[model samples]
Target: MNDHDRTASEVAHSLSRRQALKVAGGSALAFAAGRVVPSGADAQTPPSQPADPMQIILPETGITLPTDEVTFRWVDSGDSKALFFRAYFDAFTQAHPNIKFDYLGLPWTEIAQVVPLGVRNGNAPDVFQVPQEIPIAEAVREGWVRPIDDLIPNFPAWQAGFPPVSFVEGVNVFNGRVYTFPRSTSRRAGIVNYFNRAYLEEAGYNPAETPLTWDTLRDAARKVTENGQGQYYGIILVGKQVGRWEQYVRNMGRLAGSSAGPDDIDYRTGEYVYTSDGYLAAIELLLALRDDGVVFPGSMSLNDPQARAQMPQGVAGMIFEGEFTLPIWVRDNPDFEFGVSPIPTPSASFTPMGYQNTGTNHQWLYAESKLPEVAAEIFTYLGSEAGQLAFVSITGGSDPSVFDSVNQRAPVDERMRTVYGIYEKYMRLCPDVRIKNPETSQVYLRLQRPTPSFGEIVQGIYTGQLEDPKQAMQDLQDRQDQALDEAIEAARRDGANVSRDDYVFPNWDPTTDYLESDYAELG
Candidate 1:
């Protein structure tokens, strides 16, 4: 189905907003219901003197409280710019008055080093938030964290709401159990192409509306380019950084029915749809834009922030980015004329306009902590409806499920409305893609040397440094296998289970042919 041809009904059938809410019942509803105490009730009054954190009840899921007050220390990676940690702490404290939050805000770069050290020194917060890429499974296997299954019953609900893909499948799960719950879900979509309606009209074209397909984008770029010369180009893309390049590749991969997950492409089988006709077609189309001079000059050198800056200043016509970019655009240039829509799909089949896997950022509780019960209560409440609402309100803009009540109570920007609309109708959590064996994560990290070094591989692909795609993929597979092997060996030396066959990969192939596939159908 073409992007335009695919209806909200079609996407809804796979993963609807209502179903997402139901699957995320505890979290979604908790956020919606507000505080459990009666309105104007003094939750900390003499009689109520804030029951020991262990005494708090997770009423939403019927989970009992712990016997001790658990102090959850968390650090925010995306702080200052975003209030994610503060919102979570605020909602958590209000719901469970006894539990205290030792909140810390840190840059993303510092979290990797700080978290591990904190764990060694016994100073790690009982409950903390970590980025999806930080090898959490290894932490779990190392006894730094705890398995969450014994604490709550709504885990299944949390898992069902995610999409079936490699990254989600590979990074979130360890030993067939979930260790993290995502904070904000994200997907790679075509960048929001911002056009100066004023500029388009001056160039003899209607700027108010434009088709989302690649061809339309190119044609519009051509028209816009004729008017501006070197001062502006029809579009801007991040090509210099491997991370941005990988995003581009992944976005293109989505159009071809692939993602960064194992199920979509099956790296083990050496079958990648990336080199397939559909993917190649998407690449050719993108390259055509570059060749036609429709892309901004030195686009390869531009990072996301730099590219976004051009949009408000009218230095560029269109740029592709994620949904998060909308808020910044609104904050910086209130009067900029722009519209939002899904990326266009290929002519053959209607792939959803956006990528499927939403990023997973989760909070885990320590099983061995002195306050498991209290920690569980806080964990459950944070995942509850009231908690979700509090988070949404504090963050200002979050998924509709988190802020559904607030969405109804206040007027929201069109961009936010658009994001909620898309998520409600079409968003699917990418299947769990993290390492199942916590030890394997350690190996992956060791082999990669520095975590960000993986970008070099991506850069090689974008810059044509690696001429053989098959070899490049094979090398990655080897490195991953080696990493897994190293992790397993280390575990064995430590008398832990680390066998090569011990790792379990989730099955996320949507194209699998099955007689009983109806159960797997999105509807």
Candidate 2:
């Protein structure tokens, strides 16, 4: 079969089959030019400049248009920082006079609260970034979203342009149909160590050139804290933002040997490894520093924004945060000098793992959208090579594209380049259970998390609320194990052919990406 036929077959086998896509008049050449003739423009008028500033990759072709003027609302947690939204949206409107946007660019914290409210009130944006609070699976199961295969023109050709795991089953594909794409690279996950260059210099260390070992990091925090003399501390964490604790543990846990995906379960053994040596050590290090009073004193009360804001003001010397911190600091506080490095591990030599899954987080096309075709076109644009380049250029490379080619081609500043280098040299992809067994994703959606959660457990332990850290971790593992068994049973009740074995990957390695060919061992 041809490439187009093969891609269509792959999409059909993904989650579920959908109606064949419909295409209207626009052509590849039309999208390549990123311009619109404006339904009634005079043939005499010269075409406008390219919609994509970089004008590299072709946008979507053969998109159908509405006869009357229409406005669609859009919301994303990253929009303000992404900046490309304004330019791309305006350019899209310029091409189609009848199309307009009612855009809402809010902080992720707010999006978390707003999304559920909007969905319940039937006012959710036509297109929106999936909130962290709701699992994408739950949204799909409840009919909050629809598959994009029927909306994006040329169902097969458009998706062919992305990388392998860009549209994995169970993550973005439900029942052999596509949903959304996670365009950001996992190599630049937020579990990173960002520091104040001035403070590190004062402590007689340069982390940018040589990353810190676990022990050295603790010592550095102590030194910086001591030198501050109550003026500034060595490190600050978002204790109030409970998720930060879990984020740190999971990302750094691999170094110690958690070897599982972010869910804290090691797929090799099909067991939750929260109490594993690596994960425990990561937690202990933070507690040890907090006990030594090296961590910022006011950390317990600070949220993400508050904590991140203090780093540049010299409230503390360091923060365990993600790539988002880069562009904001540069734009808002130009004078503050900072640097980012991978989160330190127990030993100087260590490995970090990243996983891809639809159940993770993604932007979705709402089921309630009256203009599904138009909404799909917007995401289609963002997912394009040219659109990705424009994003990199406008966002200052703070968030690199999923496609390596785009990251390489787009112009970036020194710090963004440094981040890309760090992700490339250090991060490794772990086994994705969803790829092996899409039904396993059903178990995840049904699984119930234990009380206090991962982050709260960390806070309770450090604040002297939860007494035994090891036991607490063990209890969490046990609770999750029970929940997994129950969820599996529930999935089976719904006619899903899945079992606990689906989560295990005997042939998996902690140091390398789990390839499609590796699934052969399961048989």
Candidate 3:
């Protein structure tokens, strides 16, 4: 059978097959040099500038349009510190007086609560920043946002400017249409093991030849513990918040080979494997650290911020954190010198491991915009090299530069170098399980909602509340599988096109990460 027939047959046997989708919309006209071009058609040259400020070539279409009096309603998840947004808005407006922006910069927390309400009320901004925690699929399905392929000219070429990894499944793409533009690289690229350089030296260990294996890291921690003499801890952990615990589990588990997060999939089988050897080994590692008395006291009671503070304050030798932590340390504890390294992997794995998110917090233009051309202009500009640079300069390189040129053009601060190195060498992209059935994302979210979460399984073991780490993981695996099945079945009942095959990851080699061709074959 051909691919289409195969898909139909699979859907029939497994889940539901959707009917032909008729999107309610009119297509935009792409006019260039007095000729009409199909949307997403390739352009030979960059868009030519028009004599009138109001009349400029649309980058996506190579079409010239009058943009004067067009006001783009932009809502962003930024606070007062995000002066870069205001700067960009002023610069863009000054450059083009005919075009205007109605910009609202709100805290991320507020944006999360307000944007959804605005969207539901048909009063949402023309262009808005996508929420970090919420899945973008929900908004696309609800018709709150529209695909950019038709709106933006030469969409695929425009998207190619970004790194291949940025196109996360079920995030930037839905129903084979590109939805959002990646605004920034992940602030937390992977699990960063930040260590006090002085502490390592004082412990008679060479910082250059730091730990690369799990066993050696433990030995190094013991050395730091011996050097501390009851005054400090070798390693600090944050167990109070669910996210912190989850990071610990993921960081440690990656070292052993577990790719299963709250809703992550095993690329090899397309199933959740929370009880894999990697996860259980990670839990056991934490238990060993506790028994060895290397973990900081009050870890269970301490909040994330409190736990994070210990490393900078010299109370802990190392911290398992993210790229953003370096900036905090730079601003607050400038006198303290430190270095970043990846979480040590097992001897068997050999390669260092860190978690990576495929997509990022992005900016999307609402489908129901009054001034689409104006909104498209702002969207395209912000995603451009110049616009991204302005934001990157202000953010102090905590986020990896999306533009390739920005990295080369940098003054190259120590922090930026560290982030670059970590992302390039250590970070491993986390598998997205919701690629096939976007509706199933809720199953993973629900697992995090409960008090004693899958991440908290380690904490349970650490506190003596749970005895067998393997059993706890096994139980979670079963629960996750059930949740996955229920979600797929319910979504099929609701006319969503999904099946068990969506979860399958055929011909994926976990050891080598496989090649891009392997992924293409599965698709």
Candidate 4:
């Protein structure tokens, strides 16, 4: 049904409930009072309740403002494992005596469907958390939210804290303006290859010092497989979606060539190097592994969480994962000896491009809100060192450097340090073009389809769905062109000034390397 119709129906339901309650209790109340209460007057007036005070607190900085009371409506994603939202509310309320938080938690699955409805209904929260990947530009283009740049000055620093080539760009910016702040980040890297030292020794190989190349990895997999027989597999690949395939593709790229600099941009030319030969070579390598029987059965359907749980159980020796899996690793396999290293390249000549998988800052204000200044104040507080630290501490993540001093004693992890190193050295701040306008963002998503008919030609060769790679590639290119044309046309119809030149495809070639040799060199 249309939005208006749905809204009318909901209103009718609410009115019906109110009418039923009155009918059930009014007669008894009138008899007890010994008088007949006027129907219209009683119906028009409802008992008033005292307003709750707004409470605000900065957890990391230990700043408390309990006197300022405000009720915050938030989506309650049903995942019990995700305590970030609830923890944030509790921490804020406990610290601020004047500020009281009214939380409205909705199921995770309903979040996307409900958020827009909230905004339209004037029931939107002062602060809301969203996944880094949700399209924010669409919200802005429709005037569903306001630009937050004027409200938060430290936004640039928050944006710079992430690895530039990562998905942060897709999360924060919309139509040249920032809209949402990131809370976490993720990276797609090759499997964390672990070998059974005993098995490797029996196979006449030194597991600790083995070269971390695709060929060496495969060789080790073969040896490990001999020991497994029918009980265990030599390797496990969580190949459930394009996300899994991305890690394999990245690893293969390292073998084929080096990555283009993360800071490098050619928005006007749409000349991303990710489409280069190196990237294709990487895809080919992954396909080769799939064909070699090194990967476990049912790999294409297995997700990352299942793969992670299986590792400590000894179901597989290697698994590809992001940094968030560290906590689980420590919990399930405390005594399990493992080593952490950057994913390896094909050769010494190649430099692997790592993915930065974390959240970012790109909050926005509501231009049409009745409490614009108050909303701005809330957003400003969020960007403040005190505000950001509180968010980080509660969520078990790091805050932006601009807010670092707020939580001086917070524990640091090796993975975070490594991520920071990458951010400082090779990463660049991602442009906010995608979210600059809803139409453009929609076009970009359409262009990123993972099927051959939709411009993802490499899918055919990797999945063995096509015999002729060259023909498939050509077909994919044709599909991409058609999609781009359609996108451009749609944008024009929506009055958006988009063109082929506006797109920024990633470049994954070695010839353009310009990042400093090491993270230390970045300074």
| lDDT (Cα, tens digit) per residue for candidate 4, span 1-523 | 1111222123222222211111212342101001112222234432111011011232222222234455544333322112233433443443444555454433322455666666778766555543222445455555667766555445576445434432333355554566555433332232444444454555565534544566666676676666778555657776654434544554455335534323112332454434557666666666776676766776666655556667666665556555445433543355555544344456534554433333433334544544444444455555444444444433223332333343343333454455344334333323234433335654543343324331123444666777765566456556556656786777677676677655543332333332323222322
Question: Each candidate's lDDT (Cα)?
Answer: 0.49, 0.70, 0.58, 0.45
Off by over 4 Å in 1: 1-73, 77-81, 84-135, 142-178, 184-210, 222-226, 238-243, 257-310, 353-359, 364-380, 394-396, 400-411, 420-455, 463-474, 477-523
- In candidate 2, what are the lDDT values of residues 126-243, reduced to their tens digit? 8887765456677887788888888777768878887777787667887788888766766656657889998888998788887888888988898898889999998999877667
Arranged by lDDT with the best first, the candidates are 2, 3, 1, 4
Which candidate has the top score in TM-score? Answer: 2
Better of 1 and 2 by lDDT: 2
Tens-place lDDT digits, model 1, residues 1-523: 2111222223223221221111121343222212233222434532122222111122444566543565666554432123334333444566666666666644333555677677778877676655334455555656777766567666667545333431332345555565555554443342444456766666555533433566666777887888787787787776654445544555555655553342223322324344445554655566577679888887777655566667777766777665656654554356788766545554334433232342434666654466665566555655554444444433335333322343454333666667566444333333221234445444332322233333455556545676665566556555555655666576577665455443322343433321224223422
> Which residue pairs of candidate 3 clash?
60-153, 270-503
For residue 393, what is the lDDT in candidate 3?
Answer: 47
Better of 1 and 2 by TM-score: 2
Prediction 4 TM-score vs. true: 0.59
Best by lDDT: 2
List ranges where model 3 is wrong by over 4 Å.
1-160, 163-169, 175-179, 185-189, 259-263, 298-310, 348-357, 363-378, 427-453, 456-468, 494-497, 520-523
- Residue 373 of candidate 3: its Cα lDDT? 64
Q: In lDDT terms, how accurate is model 4?
A: 0.45
The digit string of per-residue lDDT tens for model 3 on 187-305 reads: 24445778888887777654335545677767778888888998887888876654566667765675566653334456557776567777667777778788888888877776544
**Model 3, CA-based lDDT:** 0.58
TM-score of 3: 0.67
